[model samples]
Target: MKKKYVLLFLIVFMLQHGFSQQMVLKKGTILDALPVQDSIPDTFSLYLPTDFTTEKKWPLLLIFDLEGKEKQALSMFVQAAEDEGYVLAAPRVLDSISLSNSIVKAGKVLSKVVGMLPIHRERIYTAGASSGARFANLVPVFIKDVKGVVSIGSSIANTELLNVKRPFHFIGITNKNDFNFTEILAAKKVLDRFRFPNQVLLHEEQTEWPNIGYLKKSLQLFTLAAMAKGFAVRDSSYIEKALREDIIKVNRLKNAQKLLLAERYLGEMMSIYGAHKNLDSLRQIQKNIRKDQRYRTMRRAENAALFKESLLKEDYQYYIEEDVITHNFNNLGWWNYQKSEIDKFISGNNIYEKEMGNRLLGYINALTEDNIDIVKSEALIDEDALALLYMLKTILEPQNFDFYLETISLSSKNEDFGTALFYLEEALKNGFKDSDKLYGLEGTALLRITPKFNALVEKYLKDARYEIIEE
Candidate 1:
């Protein structure tokens, strides 16, 4: 009987070993993407570290792109993940997929990756950008064992859905120009109310992706959170190193006279490390800093600015819906006036108004982008509504000549000559200098021959009133 039991134990061990061998992947390369499941078009990409082997389990980050740019998103984190020793996976969840379906696909990815790679189930995380970022941050609500998320260029999708029972660390990345900038602050407040572990990295809002340094910062946040919460065994050396670097950063910002930035970073460190490490020294620094008159004024002003942002967001949203539904093209002038007012506030000396103005601009543009998306893909198609939105969009984003041309095309096609003529004048008044393009607009057969159209030609192009530019 003893001999038989020994043989059975040996057989079981071999079987388990065989399974693990099959799961091992080539190190230091992004493996070809695989389907998440049988029928779903959902697929995922992966990158394993050069030293990664089935011998040891690694922490995992399941990243995603809402538009199915999975490999690109995965690549973005490759350097940071490699440096921090994380196994990264990213799902190519298409934008066309419903959010619930995307969530289901993500679950499949987690299950498959956990099985194939020796992933530490307890250390699983998620990440993405924009709408994908919102979805990544939203996943912990449905799934379990998501320890953290790196959400870039977005805020929490819906605060009502947050669960305090299963708290996850959230790291938000955005720039001042990102439409989600103010929304992130608002979302941070909600996270604070629930006492969730969170940090935000605000970068320069520019045309390019944030520098690799930002990704490294995110990795540090993840590492610190994991250690602080005891999800991973504590690494005192790493913690000490991070704290020291952060201190240097705080002092650097203060010396640069970026007082608000310095104060914000100090607050983040206190929130993250207050209980985990000795913070008396940090507290003293913070207390002395808070007593400064400029710091207090800036903090108070920011709160007032946030309140103003919320109120203006309400106004922009109400007008967007009302104007779209009512086809109130007349309100374009009012919208233009609002934009000019925001501009004045932006260029003004008062810090509070300037901040509010910048935030409001981002907020309105985000709303306009959403409205444009709905008009393109929603169940109900409304051309008139789209045209009215274009008219308002031209005013809200006057620098965009696309809205002007779209407005003109839509109005002329719908036989609304009066509205078409009014916007033509408005576009010129707004300093649209492209006179050649103005006379060359296509698809205006019925209305382009009118005197108002000819007037535009004569006033701007220096062309004869009777002469029409043909496409």
Candidate 2:
């Protein structure tokens, strides 16, 4: 009887271990979105993590990166998901267009795929790198019921599209010597403007390409870190050994060359911002880095944007050298750059800000005006403020002509022709580079003006009473 009891206990143990109670989506089948009998497309590849099963309703995380055998990365995410009782269903965001566009299409495909699985619709999430980050950022915009997102190795912007009330966690992983540090700083500034919580982890170890297993490790921890915040997982079982080793190699283990790399990165950041000039925030950063005496530098002008950039960049570099030291990389040093811009805008003292606003509004007004008999409604733009938007839009962002034209068209449809013509004239007067577009818009607006420009043209050809305006 004792032997029988032992055998039963062993059988149950084996079952429990084999059928991991961990929550992960395992078993991925190629879910073709094309019609039945259609050939398989290269754009659609689905990966299921290890814990997927048909019996239980699982939460899902859709990864939207390019096709690389991220088998290890996917495995770590799966382990974390399983530990947190969630499923990971990463679809290769079809490469046909931008990640945002692909995400829109993926939303439909996601619904179809999840419908066939035992997935609960309430807790969907997304994460990606590079182009994938853009798609992951947009997933919540196009898909409903997503709880959060995790972005690795890149950043997400256009926060307006996101469910603002929902939590957004961003993690960026880059090397200490990365040339895009300035670009990364700029992106951080933009995110600060939008008030999103983000962290940048700069890898300090210099193993070169072949020796840099630490880079992968840092990325995995970043994934885990985001998973912890977004999904609320807290257990070692979620992080496999491979992940832990990688994290230790890059973060815990540091060498002299890596330390030098960290210093150079910090110096570059400090030089850009002249943070040593700021008293309070820079002082606080100094207090934190007291041990690293060499980081001290002379202060420069009162440029908070430059200062914040310098501080974050330098601190990130420090963290890279000494993984043991951790700092709030999310803090943009409590500087109010946006407020300063707003103040200048309010005071009408900042020329660039004034112009940008005027150009935008002017373009809006111009696009909205139509014929005298059918006046389109006034646009949301404040006429006085929009002059600057128009000035900047026409001069600085010439690439926006098409978009400006579209906005004008929509405004005209909803409102009048006169206003649209005014914007066209403003754009033209302010060095609008695209003459072809200007002529087309001008012609369209004139066609709908009072007294009928087309009719007048015909009458003028016969009676010579009206003269056409030529540019």
Candidate 3:
């Protein structure tokens, strides 16, 4: 009986060893397309810190890339995850899939990771940018154990779905030029009403990922929150280091005469460190800054800009709807004139107006894209509406060659060669020199070979793919 038991133990050991060998993941590297489960078709990309080991539980940041760039998304957080000693995982969820299905897949990936890794149940968080950020904000709603979210370039996906009892730490990072900037500020008010712990970080770029330093700061905020709540042990050195860094930033902002930004940072610092340490001094500084005449004036200007932006956005919404429904090609000139007015605001000396102008530009483009998607997704497509939107897109973003090409293709599809040829020449005038793409544009076989098309291509690009044979 002893001999038989020894043999059974040996067999069990071998089976366990074989299973481990099948997934020999390396730390400090990103592993792509790892299956969530043997039976499930979904896969996830993962990154383990260089010091990662099964000896202790580590925080896990589940990242989402709605465009399906899992590895790319993982790379953005890898440096911060490594420095912060956190595990990063990005599932293959995409915007192309239904939100419900994406949530199910993300839940499965989270479950699989928790089962396989030493993930701290209380330290799990979600993060993403833009649409992905919006999706990440929804993860805590559907999936339990999500302690926080690091949402970049967006706000909550649906405020109505939020449960106050299950509040998570929300860290939002956005820029003035991002169309979602004002929306995020408004969402902060909602979060405040729900009594949810939240912070909004502003960066100085258009709609894109925040600096990697901001990424690190976001994870640091999560760590601080964990310590404050007793979810993790307090590290005096870490907390002091973060506090010093923030104070230095505040001083720098103050020195630069950016009182509004300085006050905002000071307020954020007070919230973050208030539980960990005394913040009376920081609170006083914020109070003083707010009382300053220049700061108060700046605040008023910002509020005025916000109010004007809302009215302008409403006007844009109404005009766009009316134009799209009427297929009002006559309103194109009006749209062009509005672009000029926006340009004036952008170039004006008023910083608030400049920021508002950038936001409006981004908002209009997003609005146009949304309408285009809506029209295309309908059971019966409206080619005329699409063509108009595409033309408007070109006007809004003149350097964007894709919309010009799209307009040309749609016109060609409808056998509107005059419109097609007109856009083709316009595209060339706007420095679109892709003769190959023009030649290969869908529904433009005959259009591309036309004398006008070749002449325009030859005029701008100095080369035409096809020669029109004169009869």
Candidate 4:
């Protein structure tokens, strides 16, 4: 009997050890589809730095990708987090779901991560881009312990929800040509009034992710903030290095004759390093930059452009609504004319006007997308309204073949072969050469077999899926 009991105990111990080994997550790489809870359907993606271990708690950045691209979003932050010695997690929340549901899903993932990882509770932050950025901004408001938010390509969704006592570090990263650029500046004022710690980092691209360098700076700011707040031990070397790099960036901008950008970055530097070091010299530099005649002139020009942009946005809003409601196909020419006018501004001599033009272009495209989503979600969908919007999208973004295909499909679905063929030809004119997609497109079975379709395909792509019978 004693020998049998000893054998059973050995078997039980081996099974327990095997299970624990299987549960260990690999370090230094992305792990996808980790279950939040076995009973719950939600999952998340995680990235651990190569040196990650349970020996000490590390900062966690919860990323939200509105398009459900959790792995992609986590990938954007992986290198930054690795260099910063932070843990990265992205919940499988999507824009298709309601805001409340998205929050719940994110909350579950946050809970799971906190439970599973050795996370620094006070150093927790959130990040995302575009609509995802807006969602990240809202996370701190609804969920406690989110100490900061790295919002990219967007601003706060609503300022009224923020509480003065619960202020979190808000780092907004955007490009000059992003439509949300002006909005972020406006939000900075509100944050200032509320005494919420905040900073905005501007890059030079149009409606795209700022490079990994900016992402690294954002995490660095979070680390600095944590040190200032006593949530993490201050590293003197790290703080000095960050300040030096920022100063170098400021000088580079000044040398490039980007006076406004240099001045803005100077102010941001003061905010980040104020708690750790003396900023008297930095403050003097900012004061001198503000006093410079050329800086004043450029600042005035940018303000004027911002004012004009606001008025033009209102005009675009009114016209797009009117056009969509009336199905005003005739106004397509007017839209094209406006796009040309904006193009001239883009390529014009005035730098501020060029940026304004880019922002206007981004604004109109975003407006169209919002209206499209609204029309799509209605109880009874308006096909005509959607068709007009898709047509407008083609004008706004001619090279985006998806919009052209959507236009063709919608027209074909309505049996408006004339309109369908017209758009199909326009698509081919714009260098769309996907003969297979055209042939396989839904509601295009009859249209694709038509002579006009085959001719346009053959003319552009050199091969038509169907032969023209010459009826």
Candidate 5:
């Protein structure tokens, strides 16, 4: 029989230690050097379990690491493979090709080697850290049947490379004091934005011999790998319940932690949504208000009172309202502040603002800080004051609203319909759509009230020419 079809029901092997232990690795070319070209040979490796020789071909786990020789990461894979019942492979990408070319060439070779062994070609999996993680992410797209990927200390920027949506679990492990913290954080943000179901594992917090983090990392890899291969380490509901409990335990704040937590949470909300007047859902309103010290101590009895006040109040003056929305020189100041903040938090730039104006500008621009200057400047309404005046006039006279409507309509037409609709709605609601000369403006205003009006009339002059002329 060919090696793959050979039904060896029971197989065993001896290790260098010479003990005839209960075998998991089948005697195969698990570790071997392969000749890629005539002269250049590349070393590849794998671990096939003894149980793999049973009735069915077993699945395989692929590990890509720096030179694929990191013993700790490899050991974790070994234990996990045996525990979960699968073959494990770790390929030395650097030994074969450069970092950039290693992805395709190494993946093809790995798939070829796995094919010769008694492995379920359909259940191949991959995991890696840093450059290794990058390769694992690339393989599933090119390597035919890679079912899942575990990305550690790396991020997927070009998401098109990820062909299989089976299951991707990203675990970020970075030393808190590592100089690469910013780069790692940027990678984490990219992963988050991609909506990958992931967990940001901070390794610095786990301080023990060999570190508690290694255990956490290994478990994450194992759980996700098992999930991809259609196996259950524990009951699904039990796993979810455990994860939820852990979130609660970790996220709960202690004494004096509430203030910082509130600041961070509100700041985040403001950053995301900006100065939107209508915040969605009661849950969001409550979440925002609960961050404040005043509302933090609120009881069930005070719910109604707190709820009403919080929704109407703009007491939050931190990073959200000030920095993102009310800055002067949204002209230049806002852009500069955003760049600086991004440089500070995301890029690790540590420049101190030497000029007081710039520092004051940052504060006034901050959603968390006082924005009195921005408020004052907005009140002044300097040069473009005529537009506001005309807008007010249009509001008072619905009939004569033609001029304002025409301007906004033209502006919207140049852009997209959404922008046009926004301006149109704002003009109407804020009384800027009225025309004193046109008595039927009120009736016309009522006709265009719904959002459906924008879609219906975006190409109105062309398609609905008769309708416009009739109006």
Candidate 6:
């Protein structure tokens, strides 16, 4: 009971006297560490613009990076928020905490931020990637005053909860080969049907993270939304500049003979900027694009490709779920066969099929990693499921040496040298050449000294760190 009052008193003190301390954190630089809290130390990363001051209220962007990668995420989001004169806050949540618990902790950190700074009540926003992205979208559903969401690598948390009467601007940024690519697009379609203010930004290729520019564009979307909704004053010059940049990007795609890309890009611009900026020029580009049979054919082809991608994704999800439950290591052959099919499409004559194939690979890997995180972090840890994932990782990505080493380490830690030895051999066979790093791996001391391990290492590279011995 006393602890509760102490917490409350600390909160009150921070609310009343947060700015009394010298604001030593540099303006442009990302303070990747936790704030100096006088009471409870909640881990959070913050970025204040160079011109930041407590005199005026500022828009705030609360970023949630579920993996506790505060520094990297802060760096990724800082530029966009700084450019748009918004404060960015990213909290460090642990894997041990339940989702609900983390959300509550995040709320506490946000409250501390609100207490410390003068935040524009109407312009509070949230952004994140993967599960964090989904969570960011879900925030406004439960909390008040979140005017928008910038979700990278995901769709909205729930479409059913979307109310046109109280809608928040949604900006989705994803890569073409992302596992969530189709889902993100579908989310946009659902938002479109609801007449929800939303825009989907798709980038080229597969990447775990979006390029900073996509994020910058996403931040710009919020700025535009604030102006459009009268949360902030409208800036005609800024709108025109943004529209001009969008046109140049479209032209660049078209000039590169990427007419299909240009068409889609223009369509997205129309959705995002048609109402705010003068649409006569953008509509002109769309009219010209409609005249091209090449683009028309490509659109149909893309739809067909999407249908195929959806089926394969469903297959992956279904089989993976079943496999996780049954520990169907034998069904790895089926997964391998699916990979072969994906490879065929990757090398196919049609560009759409190739992209779809890459998307499948990306989707599978992402799901695999997510499952690994789940199993590794489970309350009753499923060591077998984790071992299975590491084994599957060796098969799915033969060249990625980390999985083999990790499997070996897990086996060694469990004092199962037979399993350890097998994976050690597999790692060497897979062309992992860094012997010193292998010898230097921590928690593999027992495995490292085995004659079998030494033999494998010596055979691969004569300079084995441990000498071979005969008993």
TM-score leader: 3
Considering summed lDDT, which 10 consecutive residues are worst modelled in model 5? 350-359
Candidate 6 lDDT over residue span 308-417, tens digit each: 99898899989887888788878889988888898999999988888898888888887899899889777898877887888778877989999988888888888988
In model 5, where do residues sit more than 4 Å from their true spots? 1-40, 48-59, 68-73, 82-86, 99-101, 116-123, 157-169, 179-181, 192-195, 205-471
lDDT of each: 0.78, 0.43, 0.88, 0.88, 0.45, 0.80
Per-prediction CA RMSD (Å)? 7.7, 17.2, 6.0, 6.6, 23.1, 6.7
Q: Write the per-residue lDDT of candidate 4 for residues 1-471, one digit (tens) a residue.
A: 222112111011112212421234767778899876655689899888877767799999999898879899899998898788899999999887888998889888887778667899998899999888999999999988798999999999999899999999999999888889999999999999998999999988654688889999999999998899898899999999999899899989988889999999998888889999999999988888899999999999999999999999899999999998998989989999989989988999998899899999999999999999999999999999999899999989999989889988988988899999988888889888888788999988889888888888888889987787894
Q: Candidate 6 overall Cα lDDT vs. reference?
A: 0.80
Alpha-carbon deviation at 87 in model 6, angstroms: 2.3
How well is each residue in 1-471 modelled by candidate 1, as lDDT tens digits?
A: 222112111011112323422332555667667655444566688887766667787899988787768898888888888778898898777878788987888888888788656788778889888777888987888898788888898889898988898888888888765557777888999998898889988675453357777887788888777776676778888888888988998999788866777877888888777657988888888888888897888888877877777788789889888988787868878888899999998899986688678778877877887888888787877988888777767767777888888888777878888877877877777777775576577767766677778777578656633665565
**TM agreement with the true structure for every prediction:** 0.83, 0.39, 0.93, 0.91, 0.40, 0.84
Clashing pairs in 1: none
lDDT, candidate 3, 396-438, per-residue tens: 9999999999999999988899999888888888788777788
Question: Over the stretch 1-471, how does candidate 5's per-residue lDDT look in tens digits?
Answer: 335322343333323233342332334325344333323455556566534655566766777776646344555566446545666677667634555577665665565455455666655667776557667767766655675565554555356554334435444444333323334456556656765544444443312112433434444444544554455333556445534443343345323343333333343333222322233542364465566565455333233433432332233223333333433223334344444543343233321112212222222223221232243357563322222323323332334545356435443434434534554555555444233322233334433443345334433322221233233
**RMSD to the native, candidate 3?**
6.0
Alpha-carbon runs more than 4 Å astray in model 3: 1-21, 465-471
Q: By descending lDDT, how would the candidates be arranged?
A: 3, 4, 6, 1, 5, 2
Q: Pick the candidate with the highest lDDT.
A: 3
Name the regions of candidate 1 deviating beyond 4 angstroms: 1-26, 37-40, 176-179, 204-209, 374-380, 417-471
Number of clashes found in candidate 3: 0
Residue 337 lDDT, candidate 5, scale 0-100: 46
Better of 3 and 6 by TM-score: 3
